[model samples]
Target chain A: MRILKFLLVKEFKQIFRNKAILVVIMVMPVIQLIILPLATNFEVKNIALAVVDNDHSDYSRALISKITSSGYFRLSGYCNSYNEALVLVEQDKSDLILQIPPHFESVLLRENSERLFIAVNAINGVKAGLGSGYINEIIQQYNQQLRSKLQVPGKFNLGPTIQIQSSNWYNPNLNYQLFMVPGIMALLVTIVGGFLSALNIVKEKEAGTIEQINVSPVKKYHFVLGKLIPFWILGNVVFTLGLLVAFCIYGIVPLGSLITLYTFVMVYLLAILGFGLLISTFCDTQQQAMLIMFFFIMIFILMGGLFTSIDSMPDWAKMAAKFNPVSYFIAVMRMVIIKGSGLYDIRGHLLTVLGFAIVLNAGAIVNYRKTF
Target chain B: MHSVIVSHLTKIYGKEKKVAVDDVSFSVDKGEIFGLIGADGAGKTTIFRVLTTLLLPDGGSASVGGLDVVKDFEQIRQTIGYMPGKFSLYQDLTVEENLSFFATLFGTTVAENYELIKDIYVQIAPFKNRRAGKLSGGMKQKLALCCALIHKPNVLFLDEPTTGVDPVSRKEFWEMLKRLKEQDITILLSTTYMDEANLCDRIALIQEGKILSIDTPANIIKSYPDVLFAVKATNMHQLLQQLLRYPERLSSYAFGEFAHFSFKGTPDTDGLVTYLEQHGLKEVMVKTADITIEDSFIKLLG
Candidate 1:
């Protein structure tokens, strides 16, 4: 315990002494929290839609008017021909294009049938898919209005219909901030925790202090543990601070008990600290440690299901994600925050994270003592 | 019992079979300052690491204070204080903090062992609040010494502790070690400075991962086995060329301001002076100077 205390004090002194860490901990988190969420959106709102009405009759004009009035599509331009609409899309001037067939008024009245063409920019697949869905809804609504006007009888004919009613729990509005805040909390904590611990040991190597410890009465295990615990606690503190900022600034309230959240976070920190220790042991310089950690953090965050859903991934990718500790932590955080799942519900995630912590720490302890 | 001991200690770094410390065996008696003098990459640091239990030898065995380095590694760690070649204390912490921290690590207090490090620690104590990283090269050297001695280890292993420090600091550091020797602590120090070899009770001049000579500095210098002389004249370049041309001059090498030479047999100083005058030289000085450890080191290498 005394050795642990000495190490903790040293770790604290090291962390608080660096102005760079102060900026990363106190300032960077706020900046990212404020700006990152505003830029990240999957709902595809406020799409810029354009239309070309070659059929200059009442039928085509009415269809165009319905599309323009729809809340989903923001009509920014009315082109004269297909070529002009294509030009707008190719130049990235518009997200979607709606074209009405020529002689649509004559054909709709005589034949009781008409066709409308919808061309969507597929460069951004998600935005294009949403735009196509919006245009389809508008055309269906206009056709229903025309049918009601030519009503035959009060009796209705039976037909097949498909409907999807999604009941989004906790965050019924599906606020992206609500989903992103917890994931970001995990990412920030992991990064700072891993980075600082790696630097702590590597700084020893750089300054030649590891030699002092190496020659001193302290055992390698004592040294490695002394280095790990302080950062583990710090990682938790940063994790909690980030959670508070999420609540205070973004109004993102966690539905689960804070104790459970903290418990999972503590377990998660072990894996991160282990990774940092491993990096420090392998690297001779702090710069090398930082670069290697930056690479690891990049891969972990990108594959951690922070912004993307793991369930939506391909089979092999999802299988790979199952082995990723970040994926489970993020999934567990979302489950608890959005669904308020209890320990029993998240027991699998807890076990996996616990196993990861043990394996990584074992590897770290063994590798950390190795001579360079 | 020796303060530190090793027998047939060999360490191979990798599968490629690079031998760092090869069948090395040495021991230091208690209360003695021993020098392991060598050039860079001469396995001096590797030997220190092995004895400190920082690295396990691929073969053979070592013990510090009667405790096996590998079998009783923890005991060895508790018994020794190591200062590596690089300045390695917590730079963020102040001098006092680093000293106090290392003291506490050994289950001891700075106050409890104040006498053990009082002299060296006092010199840097005034700046106790200043961070270790911000201190000057000499101050950092002192602070490292104070921290290493804080625990009052039975043996101290300093691996080239004064490598980059200024000469004055190096001199002062040696004086501190001389004082520490009174406390009966075993000191095993490695250095590249041949001058420092004289300060040790016994010195081992090492090269290419091999011990070339091990003896008291006086004895090593005395055993040069030749008639050595220092000769300097006007146009040293031309003088050196002429000196090397003589077959009677067994060896000749520049030493500071004068050229040191060894002759195969007794040479007439007047005859040599007349020869130099005839060769068109001025301001010639011929003198016999005491050989230093560096002189012996070069001779041993040769």
Candidate 2:
């Protein structure tokens, strides 16, 4: 234990002495937290729309104005014919084109019905899907307005018989930044802790300092722990800074207990940093460690359920995600921050992380060969 | 009891299938300066690493202070101080921090073993605040030695500690080692410099991962089989070529300003002088030379 204190002091001193890595740890994460949340938003807005009116009637004009006034679409082109609207879409001036049939108002008054055609550019799938959905909602709202104007309560009732009154429970606004920031914070923590600790023992190996340590009476567990705790503490520190960024920039605070959040981060870091030392033990050079670390981290980030929903993934990837420790932490982050989930809610997640921490660390210490 | 003992130690690098140390054996008496003298790749460092518990031998056994290197590895580690071939002190750390860290690692304080490293550490005391990376080669060597000795282990293993050091610093380093020897600390060091071999109480000459011969410097010189003659001509390179072509010449090599020549049959200086003059070589000289360790080593290589 006394020897471990000295090792910790020496490790910390080395970390603090390297100015470039220090900046990468403490400052780079803050900048990434600010930029990634804002840049990686999923909410697509400001779709361009083109309109064709065969009957320039009040109904047509009202519908046009209403769609424009919804602030979701902009009037990019006005086509005199269906062919012209097709041209507008072809020319990339519009994402959606709404075509009203001839005698549209007369048909509505005479037969109490009308038909309209919508052409959407489906090259960019997400934009096309969301854009057409918004147009359909506007048409439905226009039909209700026409019905209400036609009569008082006895004559006409156009309101839906059963209303949804849909309210997004946790994230009322559906702010993508709020959803994305915590996961990005998890990624930065992984990078800082894993990258640094991955190079720790390998660095000593390259410098030949490991020979001196191997000949000394230092226990393998003491050496592994001495390398682990410093980075684990720094990982939490980086996590705290990320949380502060989330609060100051995105106004996101964990609705769950802060104590529970920190407690899980502590366990989460052990599995990650211990995995780093595991890589350190297997590699002979820092470059090899970095390459292997890069490979694992790339897989972890892509399959971590940070960007794509795990539920949407195919069966095989879901099975693989079960093995990814980042997936558990990301779920923990979302559950605690957005759902206000308590510790009991995350009991299963805690068990998995605890298991991972024990297994990865045990593997690292066992593989750390005392002799060359 | 001997501070270190080895019997038929063998180590093979599994990947390359190269034998790094092959069936070598030696022993170091307590408090003696035992030098393993060889060029680079002579397995000197490999032996040091194995005995220090930094490496395991594939065959045979070794012990430090009567403790088996394999079974009592932890105990061996506690009793051995190792300074590897490379300057392995933390380059980013201050001199004092590196020393204290090593001292504390062995469950001792630098203050507790201050006397053991005092002679070496005092030279580096003024630079205690400087980063070790910025020190000169000699200063780094001294600092490494100080860190190794801070725990005051029973035996010291230094692998080519003077390989890259400057001349003045190398002399100072040997002086420090001589002082440590007086305190009855068993010192085992390896060096490629043949000149440095004479300073050891006993030395082992090794090459190609095998021990060629092991004895005191004077005894190895006395064991040279034939009398050596130093020959010189005005044109030295051509003279060496000419000496090799001489019918009676068994072997010839350039050493400094003279060509070392030996004859298979009994030599006559008058006969050799007549041959050199007939070959039109001017300013010819030949004199009987005292055999040094290097001469014996070259002769033994044959």
Candidate 3:
């Protein structure tokens, strides 16, 4: 108990003394919560457009007006020729370009023409694809209107005859925050759990106080536990803070029980912190720890499904992710928040995390055992 | 009575190739100040770590206060105080906080054993609220000593405690150890500083994972088996070369301003003066030099 007290006081003092921890634990999550969601989105907006309208007809003007009026794009300039439109696009002044033929209305009226030039920037591939699809849908609507005037059979239908029903589970509105908050919570915990704990332990080793503890009456397990427990609790606090901020700011309420979420969080924290302790055992300096942690954080964020789905990965990578504790935690958080999954739904994840906690920690203890 | 004892202690590190502590064995009597004096990587810290129960020797056994370091590691830890070479107190914590934390860890309060560390503690007690990381090297050293002694352990292991500290603080720290000795607690210290060997009741001079000699400082110096002389001349570097060329010289090493040399036979000052003059050496003076532990170390290495 005294060892525990001593370690806790020391850990708390270190957290306050070091502004780096404050920045990572407190400020970063908030900034990422607010800014990342706003910046990193699949939804495309504010597309700059250039038009090459050689037809000089009412129909082309109306089509250009329709494309520009959707609030998704702005008409940046009117090019006199296709070359000017191409130049604008190559210069990065416009993201998309539309070209009309010299006899656009005449050709449409004479032979029901089809080839139309729609150039879009593929640098942002997903955005370009979605924007082009949106434009295609608008032009299809315009064609339907023209067909109605021409008295085409089965035209001008307000709705499809084959009806399809859609339903959303858990978060029925499909709020982006509802999907992101839990992952953010898991990510925040990992940064605190994996990086901070490793650096903290390795720093003590570098400073030589580790020798003091080695010689003290404190058992190796006691010293390791003393260090791990405080950081583990701090990880929980940061996780909870992330949860609360996500809820208050974005209305991203968890569908599962808070107790259940925090329970898995607690178990997940052990595996993460154990991994950090294992890293500290192998590393001699804080700089080395930091470099290794940078790699860990990158792997955690990428494979943990923060921005991509692990299921989409190749067979080997997907199998490898099974042992990743970050993946399990992120999966559990998503299951609990988005699917309203009960404890039974996440039992497999819990067992995996528990296995990791036991095995990794045992490995760390064995590797660091002080047999000279 | 022996407070610390070991038998044929050996530690080999890699695949049966490297021996960090090879067949090393020594004992420290109760209430005595013993030193393991050696240069860096001479296995002093390894010996200290093994004795403190932080490490288990590969092929030998050690007992402190009659408790085996391996079998009774928990009890051994409870009985010893260790100050590692590096300044390793919780840098974020204030001086008072670091003291209290370590004191509480040993199940004692600082107030209970204030007398044990009062002299060193009082020096930095005025700035008790200052963070340990922000304090000077000397203050950190004093605080580390206070922390180590807070528990009032039966034995203390200080591993190269004054390696980077300034000379004055080093002097003060040794004086503090002298006072601690009067309290009748066994102290096992390690240092690379040869001058500090004199301060210990007995020192084991070690090099290359082997103990060259272990004895009282006076006895170790007394056992110099050669006529040692310090030679100085106008050409200091040339004078060293000239002294080494003499056929009767055993060993000659530059010590401070003069080159200390050992003789193989009778003192031949007149013959040496004639040889130096022939070598164009001016103001040649030869005197008996005090053999330091460093000289003894170099000779033992040779």
Candidate 4:
């Protein structure tokens, strides 16, 4: 116990004295929490649209006004011919083209239907898909208005209409930042905890100081715990700072009990820190440790259900996500912060992370050799 | 009572399985200053590493303080103090912090063993607050020594502790070891400097993972088998060339301002001078030279 105390003091002093580590610990949470969430928004807006209106009729003009007023698109060009509108798309000036054939209003009234052509630039698939979907929805609504005006509403009722009274339970406003902040907090904590502890022992190896430690009477578990406790505290500090950034910038607060959230965080940190120490034992230099940790961290973040939903992934990817500790933390963070989940709700996640902490730490202690 | 003992210890490295320490054996009695003298890559460090419990011997067996190196390594680690060839203390930590850390790591306080490290610690006490990396090479050596000695272990292993230190510091370091020896701490140290070999009570001259000879400094010199001579002339390089061609020459090497030469049979100083002058070398001089440890080392290598 005395040995562990001294080791912790030494590790903390060295960590705080290193300007590079201090900078990383302080700057990473702020940048990841504040800037990344705002930049990673998937909501597509401001699509440039070109209109080829050969009809020049009242109905066609009304449709154009409706599309522009919907605020999903900006009218970038107005042309007399379809070829002219095609030129706008080719020049990258427009993302979509809406063409109304001649006699559009007359045909719709006389024959009950008219053809409208929409040409989308499919280079950015998501933008094109969403842009086309929005336009289609608007045209359907306009067609409904025309049908009701042309017929008597009481005589010709359009069957029974079923409306979806959809209400978002957790986040009513559908704010993207609220959904992203907790996951980003999980990512930030993983980065700070994983990288710092991974580099800790390897730095001693490069400096030749580990040999001194190895020859001492200090037990392996004592040394491992010494390395773990300091970085664990630092990980908590980074996490708290992330929470502050989340609240101050995005006006997000944990809906659940703070004690329950902290319980999960404490266990998750142990699992990640244990993983870092395991990598440290296999590496002889800081560069090796950094590269190995980077490789694992990249995989962890991508498959972690942070930016992508796990349910939508392929079978192999879902399997990978199932094994990822980061995914569990992201899940728990969202559940506790947004869903107001209690300990009973996150019991399974908490137990899995606790298992990770035990297995990884045991592996690290076993692999760490006092002799070569 | 032997504090450290090895019999035919071997260490093979890497997939290539190159022999690093080959069939080497030696022993150090209690409280004696034993040195392993060799140049770099002579396996001095490897031997030190094996005995310190940082490495396991590939073959044979070794023990420290009557504990087996491979089986009883845990107890061995507790009783040994090791300072690697490279300065191995935490460079970002202050000197005092490093000392205190090692002290506490051994489950003791600095105040508990203050008497053991007092002589050396006093020298570095003024710079206790300065980070170790900023210290000079000599100061770094001293600080490393202090950290190693903080626990006052039964055996101390120092690997090239004075390799890059200045002359004055190296001299002072040896003096500190002498004082440490009086405290009844068994010391096992390695050095590449031949002069430092004399300071050890006994040394094993090693090369290429093998021991060439093992004896006290005076005894090793006394056992030299040939009368050696130092030869000099106006054209020293040409003189060396001519001396090598001498049929009776046993060994020849350039040492400082003169070339040390030995004969196959007996001292033929006059004949050698005449032979050198006949070869057109000018102002030739020859004198019988004292056989230092270096000369004995060269003789033994032959």
Candidate 5:
């Protein structure tokens, strides 16, 4: 017990003395949390639209004005023919094109129906899909207005109309930042904990100080705990900083109990730091440890449901996500922060992370040898 | 009583299993300073590593403080203070922190064993707040010695402690070891410097993982088998060549300003000088030389 105290003091002193580490711990979280959410937005906006109007009738102009006023698109060009609009799309000036055929207004007025053409540049799949969907919704609204004017006092009531109204729960605004802030906080905490502990022991190995420790009377558990506790505390600090950034900049506050969130974060930090120490035990140099950690962390982040939904992934990737500790933390963070979950809600996630902590730390202690 | 014991100890390295320490055996008595003298790659560090519980010996058995190196390694680790061939302290840590860290690691404090390391610590005490990496080579050696002695273990294993140190620091380090011996702590240190061998109570000459000889310095010199001569001339390089061609030449090597030469038969100082002059060598000089540990080491290498 006494040995562990001295070891912790030495570790903390070394960590603070290293200016590079201090920067990584204090500055990296703030920068990454603020910038990553604003940059990785999923909502597509400011789509450029080109209109080819063969019909210059009042109804045709009304439809064009409606599409532009929806705030999802900008009217980039007004061409007289489909060929002219195609040129605009080819020049990358427009993302979508709308073509109204000749006599479109007369046909709609006489036969009560007319067909419009929409050509989308399919190179950027997300932009193309969302842009076309927005245009279709606006045209349908125009048709409803025309039908009401032409209906002879809603004769026969169109055989009982059924209108379905759906509202988004948890996040009524569908604000992307609200969804991203919690996951980003989880990711930042993971990075700080794993990288710092991974490099800690290997630095000693490179400096040849481990030989002195190996020959001394310090027990294996004492040394491993000495390395673990300091970084664990630092991980909590980074997580707290992430929360402050979320509340101040993004105007987001957790709806759930703070106790539940911290409880999960505490266990999650243990599991990740244990994994880092395990890697440190297997490596002889800092470069090797960094490379191995990079490889694993990349996989974890991509599959952690941070940027991409785990539900949309392939079957094999989804299987891998089930075992990822980062995924569980992200899920718990979103649950507690956005949904106001209690301790009982995250019980399963808490237990799995606890298992990870026990297994990885045990492996690290066993692999750390006092003698060759 | 023996403080350290080894018999037929062997250590092989890597997939090729190259032999590093082969069938080597030695012992050190309590309160004695034992030195392993050899050049680089002579397995001096390997032996130190095995006895300090940092490596496992493949073939033979060894013990420290009457504890088996393999079975009672934990106990051996508790009783041994090892300073590896490399300077292994935390370079980013200050000298004082390093000293206290190692002391607490061994379940003791620097104040508890102040008497043991005071002589060495006081020399580096002024630099207590300075980072170890910023210290000079000599000061670094002193700080490493202090950390190793902070716990006052039963035996101390120092591997090439004075390899890159200055002359004055090396001399002072040997004096510190002498004082340590008076405290009844057994010392086993290795060095590449042949002159340092004379200061130890007993010295073993090692090469290529083999022991050439083990004895007191005076006794090893007294056991020289031939009368050696120091030969010098204006053209020293040519003088060596001419001496090697002499019919009675046993062995010849350049030593400092002269060539140390021995004969196959009896003393032939006059004949050697005449032979050198006949070979067009100028200002030839010859005299019988006293055999030092280096000369004896060279003779044993034969």
Candidate 6:
């Protein structure tokens, strides 16, 4: 431990001496946390709604006004024929067409019911699906309004009503940053902590100081730890600063226990740092280490479910994500912060990350050559 | 007991099988300043690397301070200091920081070895706060030597330490090594400059991964089998080309102020003088000269 302490001191001295790297470390994650979330929203909006009305009646007009008033959609046009609606869609002016059948008000008054058709441009799957669902909900409310105006009995209202209500529990507002900020925190930590530790030994090799270290009595584990701990601490600093930005700028407060969040962070950092050390042992130059790190980091990010849902991915991609440590970090970061989950909820994830840490670091220590 | 011992050491690098160090063996007694004299790629650095436990021998074994290099490497590392051919100090750290860090790595402090490095470190102490990369070549050399000696190892392996320093710094460094020798620290260093071989108690002249001779400086010169001669002319460059044409020229090379040559057999000095005069060479002087390490090295290579 004495040797390890001195080694850590040296690592810290070397790390802080590079003012450019320190500046990059302290400032970058905060900027990313603030700016990146705004551009990655999944909530579909500004859907172009086109309406075709055969009977220009109060009831139909009321429904049209109701559809336009909701902010989820923009009215593209009111057309006379379906072909005109099709032309609007082809022109990219409209993405949905709501058609009111002939004798719409008459059927609504006599039978107290009516049916409408919607021709949606399905090129953009999310916009098309959500647009049609919004129109359907509006018509359902209209049907209820007509029955109430006629003072109809409760029999029809009770006939077959399955009131489906959903609550977007953790993020009720569905703010994308609330979802993205935590995941981006995972990415920032991986890039900073992983790349820095990966370059540590290889940089020594390039500078030739590694010969001095290798010919010393310092154990391989001590050397690897000295390279790892500083970057791990820096990773946490980046994580905490990002959380602070999420709270102050985006008004986001993690619902989970800070204890749970921090615990997982320690384990996740261990895994990432070990992976970095593994890369350092295999590479002889910092550029080679950086290139190999970039290749793996890219794979880790793309397959880690940071930007995309793992469940939505193809089977092969999902299978590949199972091996990616970054995916576990992102999962737990989101689970603990946005979902406010407890340690009990993330125990499985914690174990997986811990396992990765042990295996990768053991490999690093074993693979490092005392005589090179 | 010897400070370091090697037997039949061989190191081969690359899939192309370049023999870096081949079938080499030598020993250094405690407190002796031993030199490995060779040009670049002559495997002097390779021998130092093998002895210092920075590299493994492909075929043979070495021991430092009575610990086998392959089996007891950890213990061997504690008793040795290695300065690589290049300046290997951290460029980002201050000199004091670099010194203190290396000291700490060896489980000691600079204060503990102040008596050993004080003479060298005092010269560069005022620039302790300066980053190492900005220091001049001489200062870097002093600083590297200070760091290597901070732990007070039983043996020091310095590979071409004065390769690029100014002559003044080079002389100062040798003075420091001599003072280190007073403390009974075995010094094994490699140098391409043949003149520096005289500074050591003994040297091994090596080339192309082979050792040609190992002896004290005086003995190696006395062991020369050929009669040596020094010849000079007005056109030194043309003189070099002309001397190579001499039928009896055994090994000829341009020494600092004159052309030092030797012959396969004793030459008629008056006849050589006549040949140079006929060639329109002016200020011609021909005389027998004593053999130096450089001349010996050239003769061995020839």
Identify the leading candidate in terms of TM-score.
4
- Prediction RMSDs, each to the true structure: 2.6, 3.0, 3.0, 2.2, 2.7, 4.3
| lDDT (tens digit, per residue) of candidate 2 on B1-302 | 68899899998886888998889999999999999988788899888878887778899899989999989999988888888888988999999988988888888888999988888888999999999999999999999999888888789999998998999999999999999899888999999888899999999998888899999998999889998999988999788878878999878899989889898899877788788878889999999987888898888777
Worst 10 residues of 3 chain A by lDDT: A155-164
lDDT of 6 by residue, A79-132 (tens): 998888889999999999989898899987888678888998999888888888
Instruction: Report the lDDT tens digits of candidate 3 across residue range A1-372.
Output: 767777677777778878988888888888878877666665677788898998989889888889899888889879998788888888888888888888998889889765578899888887788888888878877877776676666667655654358999777886776777778778889988988889988988888778777666666777788789878888988988888788888877788888889889999899999999888888999999999989978987888777778989898889878877888988899998888788988999999999999998998888877331
TM-score, per-candidate, Cα-based:
0.93, 0.91, 0.92, 0.95, 0.92, 0.86
Q: Of 4 and 6, which scores higher on TM-score?
A: 4
- Comparing only chain B with the true structure, the TM-scores of all models are 0.94, 0.97, 0.97, 0.98, 0.98, 0.97
| Candidate 2 residue-wise lDDT, A1-372, digit = tens | 888888998999999999988998888888998888888876667788998999999889889999999988999988899888888888998899999888889899889998999989999998999999998998998987787677666754555576568889999988888799889888988887888888977999888887778888887777778888899989999999999989998899999989889888999998899889888988989999999999999999899999989999999999999999999999899889988999999999999989998998888877875335
For all the predictions, what are the DockQ values? 0.67, 0.73, 0.63, 0.83, 0.79, 0.66
Indicate the worst ten consecutive residues by lDDT in candidate 5 chain B. B267-276
Error of 4 at B265 (Å): 3.0
Model 5 lDDT at residue A75: 96
Clash pairs, candidate 1, are: A208-B88, A209-B88
The global C-alpha lDDT for each of the candidates, from Candidate 1 onward, is 0.83, 0.89, 0.86, 0.91, 0.91, 0.88
lDDT by residue for model 4 (A288-320), tens: 999999999999999999888999999999998
Flag regions of model 6 displaced more than 4 Å: A44-164, A369-372, B234-237, B273-285
Candidates in order, interface RMSD in Å:
1.7, 1.0, 1.9, 1.0, 1.0, 1.0
Residue-wise lDDT of candidate 5 within A271-291, one digit each (tens)?
999899889988989999999
Off by over 4 Å in 3: A110-114, A152-175, A370-372
Native contacts retained per candidate?
A: 0.87, 0.91, 0.76, 0.98, 0.98, 0.91
C-alpha positional error of residue B111 in candidate 2 after TM-score superposition, expressed in Å: 2.9
What range of 10 consecutive residues in model 4 chain A has the weakest lDDT sum? A363-372
- Candidate 1: tens digits of C-alpha lDDT, residues B1-302: 58888787888877898988877777889998999998888899999888887787888888889899889987777878888777888888888888888888889999998998888888888899999889999999888888888888889989898888998888889999999999999999999988889999998888877788888899998898876789999788988888887667778888888998887778666767777777888898888867989889888888
